[model samples]
Target: MVLPGVYAPQEDTALLAGALSDESLPPGAAVLDVGTGSGALALAAAARGALVTAVDMSWRAVWGARLNAARSGLRVRVRHGNLFTPVHGETFDLVLANPPYVPAPLGGRRPRGAARAWDAGHDGRMVLDRICREAPALLRPGGVLLLVHSALSDPGLTVGCLREAGLKAAVIRRRRIAFGPVVRGRERWLRQRGLLAPADNEEELVVVRAELPV
Candidate 1:
């Protein structure tokens, strides 16, 4: 779909597919799609008959999502805000997110454009942490939270954080993607900075699901 002023890329499509393929999702659910870059997940959920509210930080993204939703004949409420700010005090039956998971380098300039889209904070869990922390407050009783992120960001840490937040988190899906090139680049930078160990050459994209306590 044409996303107006925003750029469409393969990664966004992959993320959408990963999120929409979750079998745990209930039909006719009220869903919230956080960081809805191009509204892909939101549109897909809407197509499944779910009432979808999509949130994005970029005004461009919001407009693009709306355009795509209209073109796809899917009903989605697109809002512009950071994380859950736009939906404060609102709750949903399901929440899905494909947050930025790449950790930024130590003392270096951030990459531009779509690359900037994927960089999380230093440990790559900045957005993830906030999402997990706020999720319990935004989910209905027995509601589901689905998140797709990189294993490079420390999946165990993510799961632990979610659990600490009182959510029952479990890995429901995982796929290893080749990242030899990424590893090479990161390794070079790390070595130059006197850091030890080679970077992980492969990244595991995982889908984590959590259910609110009944």
Candidate 2:
């Protein structure tokens, strides 16, 4: 159930949601979902009895998630703003994110409409990098962060970023998925930049779990 201009639940969302379901959530665990487009991951956490707060930069997404959560009776608090900004100074027991991570050409204006949901800067680490850098601050000790993105954006780089920020991080899930429309449209540019090769129509996706020391 996704609204227009909002990112829909897809393979990556399913992978992350499945991971969330397997976790042993503490009593009333506080969960924050950054870049919560359709609130899919956030809803998963809420289902596990987590007190979920979801934030997104797009107002449409914020409302869509709020409405969806309400209909599901999930009690998610949805906010509209850039990642981490809307919930300033609030720490959580868990942080979850599915940020934009598709590498695209540089030198364009900010992505519009649904494109803003996935068009990351060249190398595809723009939003993911920011999440890695800033999310740790919103986590209490013993807190964990679950993040998902395409391997085309470099999962190892994400691990490195999280570890550098003082978290123990590792890849918890990896899957190969065929390129979606966005990637297919930008294949020529990706190949030109050596990020993709001829005949490459698929990419690997990864979920990294980063946790602070107990």
Error of 2 at 67 (Å): 1.0
**Which residue pairs collide, candidate 2?**
none
Q: What is the alpha-carbon lDDT of model 1 when measured against the actual structure?
A: 0.76
> Where in model 1 is the C-alpha error above 4 Å?
2-16, 24-27, 106-116, 180-187, 190-200
Model 2, which residues run further than 4 Å from truth? Answer: none
Best by TM-score: 2
Evaluated at residue 148, the lDDT of candidate 2 is 92
What are the per-residue Cα lDDT tens digits for candidate 1 across 59-122?
Answer: 7888889998998888999999889999999999998888777666844555455554576766
